[model samples]
Target chain A: MRIALDAMGGDFAPDAIVKGAIMAAREIDEATSLLLIGKEDVVNSLLKEYGYTGNKIAVVNATQVIEMGEHPTKALTHKTDSSIAIGFGLLKMQQADAFCSAGNTGAMLVGAMFSVKAIEGILRPSIANFVPKLKGGYGVILDVGANAECKPEVLEQFGELGSIYAKYVLGIDNPKVGLMNLGEEEGKGTVVVQAAYQRLKANGNINFIGNIEGRDLFNDKADVIVCDGYTGNIILKMAESLYDVLHEKGISDPFFDKFNYEAEGGSPILGVNGNVVIGHGVSSPTAVKNMVLQAQKMVSSKIWERFKKNYNE
Target chain B: MRIALDAMGGDFAPDAIVKGAIMAAREIDEATSLLLIGKEDVVNSLLKEYGYTGNKIAVVNATQVIEMGEHPTKALTHKTDSSIAIGFGLLKMQQADAFCSAGNTGAMLVGAMFSVKAIEGILRPSIANFVPKLKGGYGVILDVGANAECKPEVLEQFGELGSIYAKYVLGIDNPKVGLMNLGEEEGKGTVVVQAAYQRLKANGNINFIGNIEGRDLFNDKADVIVCDGYTGNIILKMAESLYDVLHEKGISDPFFDKFNYEAEGGSPILGVNGNVVIGHGVSSPTAVKNMVLQAQKMVSSKIWERFKKNYNE
Candidate 1:
């Protein structure tokens, strides 16, 4: 298996990216290869400084870099030689089994949709974030800012997609899927949420657990929580801020420690044809390493194949 | 000024409610009175048990009590003598300067809408929650579960309402109003949010600060944040959950302490024709006292009259 890493992406670019790629290369089996995509000299010099001369690693030069503030679609279309664009190019051509980047998130999503494209029969691709639940468990929440305005049908699909992800990637059996709503009652949400709740209940593929509210986020109420991207994104950012508050106040605890973005690495774009993961723009070396490993897990599980089979069946 | 306290409402009922009213009455001027609305005999007994009877306090008989789980609209209509219903009745009859309840939130909202009714030209009544900021400051967030689904026009009104609240009540001069969105860009949100952003920007009545994301909730990016009730409700509950996690983990800090519900007392229903404050259902005596004091401040500020003038202007 070949994993492509956008070495020029993230706040800690070539230095942290190269170190993380080397760390991941050492941990993966001999069968797996790591391709560092960035300015050839920059990545190579960092790799050489770390004395990382392993046969399992190679560097692919990309001339341009997409800055964090650049317009996503515009950057992808204009900067053809950028690391993000080239990484997606490699994934589309089957030269890489998966692509991982801690780069401009919008750029990554754009590349996934326009480059390798969405999986067949998928309405739209969604991103999933790992939520650390209480009592030493985790849950998956989907569409975390992918499609801010989703139709009821799209939301229902998020339930199925998130369920599959929890079951296959996270190894939760028959994952309980819950629609994130304002209240626990069936009719207790916006028009979209109410319609989606009905459809999700009728979806045979998922274990519909009815409505779950915001307070249920950190608990063991459900294995998979699904909401429109607008709501999901807000929760994701709010959780991040809470973590920030805890950290700033010098408060230390095991559960909150898990809220660290580095622990989850990156959020995977679930409905795309190929494996793609987008990490935080300010990823450190540890975050980048975990992001690579997350991508590896997705590839090993044959997530796309399962999604295709699930949809077909 | 006479403030009506729902002595039969909240988890701590007549005891805490009556004590809080007594505390408020003693703190206010001699002309102010506390009208305890509940089982008159029970409330009077509690007041008597606390100390010698004072002329500053009186009791109004309300035989029926609305349970927390009862349907809001149904209970308000059926339980005419319930503390919540009678509280509104007193407000409507000009017998009370303000009404405060720490019970059946839905019932309070229903009573406020049906009794005093919405202010003229107000699209809908909204509830505002005070968000504790990091640097010893606070921000006002609105529509926290009042209207689950809001149109663009209604959201724009929230900005104006929240701005007025921050300026008059919180003492923030020309508070910067921000429309909560998935992204900071003008067009980066759900269709409704994007439309609201445009209208908020065009609205000269408030200091519009474009868009604010979820992470900005506890930050100083905007003094008043506005969103549809659905999103606002989710964030509010999520913030509450974060506070719960911190408390459970024994991570005590001054910043986290501010997350306590008792600090802010209650959420005030804005855009209503009268001053109405709703506290937590499980509020302790301290929280009840704060809620009463909050209502006192609203009445003293003549918030409703100011709102009417602003809308007219």
Candidate 2:
């Protein structure tokens, strides 16, 4: 398995990305390779400075770099030779098992949708975030800023995708999936949520556990929580701020310490044809390293293949 | 000023409600009176147990009781003689300056809508929750589960109602109102939020600050944050859970300590014809006392009258 890394993506750029790639290369099996995609000199110099001597690591040079604030589509279209663009090209050609970027999220999402394309029957591809649970395990939350205003059918699909990801990626057996709603009752949400509830309840593939409120975000009540991207995004960001508050106050604890973005690595674009993960823009070296490892785990688990099979079933 | 209290409302009804009323009665001015509405015998016994009270306190009999689990509208209609009902009746008849309850949220909302009625031009009444800021002081967030899904026009009304509440009750001078979106950019949310943003920006009545994200909920960026009730409720509950998690983990700081609902009292139903506050159903004696005091503050500020004047202007 070969995982392509966008070395010029994150805030730390070549330094953090290169350092992370080197760390990931050391940990990954010999059969699993790392492809660092970026400008030749910059990446090579970092690899040399870091004293990387791993046979599992290699660099694929791309001349251009896309800045963090650029328009995703415009950047991808105009900067065809950029590292992120080249990373996607490697994944498209089946030269790499997965591609990860800590670059412009909008660009990463755009590349996933237009470059690799969505699955055959999927209405819209959704992104999933890992919420560190109080019970010492992680819960998967989907469409976290992906499709802000999703239709009922689209939310129902998120439930299926989230379930598969949780089961395969997170290794939760028969993951309990709950719809993120205002109330826990049968008919206790907006029009879209109400319609989605009925469909989720009837869907036999997923282990639907009715509704879960925002307070349940960290609880172990459900392994996978699904919602429209609008609600999901707000919940995700709000949870992220808790860590920020704790950091600012100089208070550190075991539970809150898990909230660091670097530990969780990156949020994956689920429901796509290939394995693609988008890390935080401010991703550190450890975060980039974890992103590569996360990609390796997803590929080894064969999540996309299993997803296609489940959808067909 | 006379404030009617729902003596039978809340999880610890009669005891906590009556105790809070007594505490409030003693603290209020001699001219201000308290009308405790509940079963006459139950309320009188509690008052007697707490020792003979002042002449400023009185009891009004209410035979029916509304349970927490009952449907809100059904309970309001069937239990017309309930404490919540009689409290509204007193307010509607000008017998009381304001009314407050720590009862069924749905019932309180229903009674507020049907009993007191909304201000003429108001599209829908919104409830505002107090968010404890990290930098000390508090920010007001509106439509916190009042209207789960609001139209752009309704959100615009929330901005006005929230602004008025912040100015008069909270005493913020020229409150900076913000449209809650997924991102801070101009066009970064659902269609409804984008439309609301445009209207809020164009309206000269409000001090619009463009857009704010979930992270700003605890920050001092804007004094008033407006969003659809669905989003508002989710954020509110999630924020509440952060306090809960911190408490359970034994992490105590001055900032997180202020997250206690008792300190904030209760959420108020703005955009209504009369002052109405709804405390948490599980409110303790201190929380109930705070709710009563909040109602007193609202009445003293004459928020409803000012709201009417502002809307007319």
**Evaluated on chain B only, what are the TM-scores of all the candidate structures, in order?**
0.95, 0.96
Docking class of 1: medium
| Model 1 agreement with the true structure over A1-313: per-residue lDDT tens digits | 9999999999989888888888888788778889999999988899999999889889999999999999999999999999999999999999999999999999999999998898887888999998998978689998899999899999999999999899889999999898888789889988888999999999887899999988899888899999888888889888888888778777778898888888878999999889999999888888888998999999999998888887776
Chain A TM-score vs. truth, each candidate: 0.97, 0.97
| Candidate 2 segments exceeding 4 Å error | none
Could you tell me the TM-score of candidate 2? 0.97
Candidate 2, chain B, TM-score (2 decimals): 0.96
Kindly report the docking quality category of candidate 2: medium
Fnat per predicted structure, each in turn: 0.71, 0.57
Q: What is the C-alpha RMSD of each candidate to the true structure, in Å?
A: 1.6, 1.5
